[model samples]
Target chain A: MEGKVDTRYWRFCLWMGPTFVLVFFLCWGVLGHNFPPFPPDTPASEVAGWFRENHNGVKLGMVIAMTFAPAYGVWGYALAKILGQVIRDEHNIIVQLARLGAAWTTMAILIATSFWLTAAFRPDALPDWMIQLLYDMAWLLIDLAYAVTSVQLFALGIGFLADKREVPLIPKWLAWYGIWVGFMFAAECLMPYFMNGAFARNGILNFWIEFLIWMVWVPYLTICGFKAIGRIEQE
Target chain B: MREAVQADLASANSQSATDDTIPPGDSGVWVFIIADMCAFALFFVLFAAGRIAQPEVYEASRQQLDGAIGLANTLILLTSGAFMAQAVRAARKGNRAATLSGLGLALGVGLLFGITKAFEWSAKLNQGIGLTTNEFFTYYFVFTGIHFLHFVVGIGVLFALIARVRKFDLDTTQQRWIESGGAYWHMVDLLWIVLFAMLYLMRAA
Candidate 1:
């Protein structure tokens, strides 16, 4: 198995995970004006007003985000491959499911950001209600489609836990942490029912707690993945 | 040879009895538990802020809640937690019958809490109160709803422990599993106590 593996290409793919994270936080999060997202209860006129003022930035940010979204898919593929090795079953159902989850998660980001882009594309001509509707639609899709990402996290965590090595590649504590992170995403289910307060999309629990932990998990996992690959090569 | 065998048995038992360096379950499980507690702490803070922001609404909503039911649920969880502790202790001592019975009792009592919660939630919905009703109801539903998810997961963990205990006398690793599951169940119970205090017992104003 080691002889057949291309370690260099694998490392390159693994690096894409952080690359995806950096680009996403910069493009979708900062420049897209999503860092402190507008409250869910914002009126249509105000929603339209922001879009009118910042349409160019939104367009740039989301377009960059959509283009680089596939980096996440590549990173997921690398993660699944490493997980296959860790669990010693390339054809494991969990590994395959995680791979599919990565694909779908990427699509979720792409489709949702496209909505934001469209909202900005014709913000001047479109009705204020329509622009607000598009904005709301984008948030609903991005936040509600969290289950796919959760599946990916769970599969990876489970796969790591299944490793029987004397010293597992990923620490058991981190695996448990990953599972906890996956479980926390269930809070996103409350987003639709909340237009304000902590359960809402921009609220503390839903956005700050949920997304911040996720952001931490991704970079943490990426670092661990790099170390795990190095260790496997030594073995 | 027989004396040597007895001495070895005694040594093993003594080590199991006296070893207090490691935690109840293992360090990994404690990590999970601590992280979960931190998340719940954040939720509690957010709830307090919400109350402070709207004292009258929170006070009115708190009045509508049934403190008796909250107390009942708290007692139910406490009882279930005690049974779970018994199961873990029995498993550690190799008392299979006691372990199985204790687990069974715990699971049965835990299910009653769930049934009660279902009824409570249904009653609220019948009264036209829901997640979207107001700030207080929203907090009430979401907090309890998330806690209910934890309860469901705890039940599954208990069932898994029961199956393992029924199948064989636990070895060291299996004993750790029992301890870990027991710790998680206790955490669930502890979270409920705080939730009950905040939502039902405390003066919202």
Candidate 2:
């Protein structure tokens, strides 16, 4: 009975991680709806038309997306908690860098969602240029400014590597995968170039593969954390 | 009984790791290196594909890039790799002084490369050749920028290696740690070579 109670805390920590992952699923603002946003060279009128046409849907999506603004900080806290399991220090440098990245991502998410909301806040209220400007800003923040999240993932991988246990807190493969996913987000840097090809914001290298890798990172770490819990038996 | 027990211990140690069969460094670093390599390879492949699509733009970008500086950086990295190879060789021979010096020299060369590369990047930026200037400059700034980031990381690895060498001991774990750092430095060099080839040397003209 005591053992069950003890494990519940571990399970709860584990649950916190996957819960944010679910929040991530709800974070499909651009990718889900106005995906690929407007191309870098998208005309102001065309972008204005999007908000005018999909005003309600975009606004609703922005609201959901804004959830990530605060939600990402919560997500980062959950991740930092999990990171605590593998990393020893309360303020370890790598972990600190990760926390910074999380905070930055949180702010970036807020700014991005605000941009989207402003764009959808009544397209007729502003000039086409302003609508277009907000639209571009929002998409760029969402896709290209992924470095914040990527840094946290890299820090997690490094933390796993630094663990001295014979059986690591997080295994090497998953650690490496986290690092890969983080670095691969650099692909978004290319999205501004080719609009229709694989590097396009919506295309494979930048969006599909990179996005898929990111979606996998959280759940993968959650599972690794669970496995680590099993190894440290109370008895 | 004692003689036999000593003999058995010797055989066990011998069987554990031979020079030919042993991995160069810690296994974890290899995983990190391979993943890093694969990430770079994807970018390389994408660069190739992009070049094929817009050969003229890529070629023009390639041309505008100052290849002499690229060549100099390559030479710097190559020289650093040689120093690291020497460091490992000295470490293997149990020559602590030579090992420390070799690693120190490599670290110096790495720092030099980083400084030179920074100047090169600054020069480009001053010329108004910035990211988002065009598709060509996009890859230009992005690739070099990421590579520079890696280069700094490699320098950090080398610094750690130099410290480890200064605390020299010819034990298995220490040897592996030092070797791992050397191997990683070599990987940094190898990656830059490939990047220089792709970004500067290979052009349509």
Candidate 3:
């Protein structure tokens, strides 16, 4: 049993190792670069100057939407599992539907409200064209909701399946997988807010925290998932 | 050993065929769906930001669109989606005839949508409102054009499924695929509903 557990751990580390590597590179490559020293007064011209220095917001937006969002697809699956349980407990199909709707509505309202904090939202921080492009991508509020719902569903599905005496649905590794997956998703939603200094100065720490988490978590969960698949096939 | 292995493989394949074998929904498919949705969402975001940048231009362009046609298309698509949903249920019951008929109805409605969209595009084109005319017109054509592309693909899939009706054994795997495909088509239809409201009804807003 101990050997099996360690094997799963090793497998998880192997799978998530790349995600950690990417996160490390991103942190080092992006945050490590010498930013033209912070301006004391962010003049409109100075801001424009700073923006001109960077690739457009459109590029940045593309990076966020394409690279970042899809990377968290598994997390979305996990979150869907969790949310599905909450929905199931409600017992009314309409209420369950409404709850899903409410969760989506809440996420949208929050994200939109975040945008209103333009000082931090910094549409100009990225390139202008990219920002406009990202702006277009941002309308995918339902997609975001789906991502969140998916994670919720996965979490709940595992638990629900485990309860059935018949299929040994929740593999031993999955519980560990769940914690990490949950962390990644929570990070996805919270990182945006924190990245823009919504919480505190030097919120760059959030990035570092996420990087550290991914380094350990991504490979671990991936391995666990693959193993789970193998076990099911073997059975 | 080789013969034994071949026999084992055949058994596994046949078991997969005959049994309740819904491909797990937790796969790459949802990722693709979300990514596609994001692409469309990006377009919507573009619309919102453009409106922010040039509300007057967008408002004027929207004003030029016919609300009545837009509403009619919305109802047609919605009805089509309902038919597709019914087809999914019928397919589950192994009602091949009902599935084919339902799929045909859905396809017909989808084609009608394409025709109406073509007419709408042409009307705009005739009125000097090509993509190059203005930013609003640019988005108008782009959004509707992309949606029409999805509709075309959906119709193609429905047609392909109709043809496959003869071979499709009523089984879990097939059901899951059809259900998801139908769900996706319905989503496309539902999205048009919102687009119609935003484009036509709220023109004055």
Q: List the residue pairs that clash in candidate 2.
A: none
Q: How big is the positional error of residue A150 in model 2, measured in Å on the Cα after superposition?
A: 4.8
Model number with the top lDDT: 1
lDDT of 2 by residue, A72-121 (tens): 56556555655655665647888787777777887887887788788888
The most accurate candidate by DockQ is 1
- Which model, 2 or 3, shows the larger TM-score? 2
Quality class of the docking in candidate 2, CAPRI style: acceptable
iRMS per model, in Å, is: 0.9, 2.7, 11.1
lDDT of 3 at A35: 20
Q: What RMSD does model 1 have?
A: 3.6
TM-scores for the candidates: 0.94, 0.79, 0.46
Model 2 chain A: ten consecutive residues of lowest lDDT = A1-10
Ranking by lDDT: 1, 2, 3
lDDT tens digits, residues B77-188, model 3?
Answer: 9889988987876776667788888889998887888888888888888887786577677666656766776677688878877777767785765666666568668767
Residue-pair clash count for candidate 3? 41
- List where candidate 3 sits over 4 angstroms from the true fold: A1-235, B1-53
**lDDT for each candidate structure:** 0.87, 0.74, 0.52
Question: Candidate 2 has what TM-score?
Answer: 0.79
Residue A174: error of model 3 in Å? Answer: 16
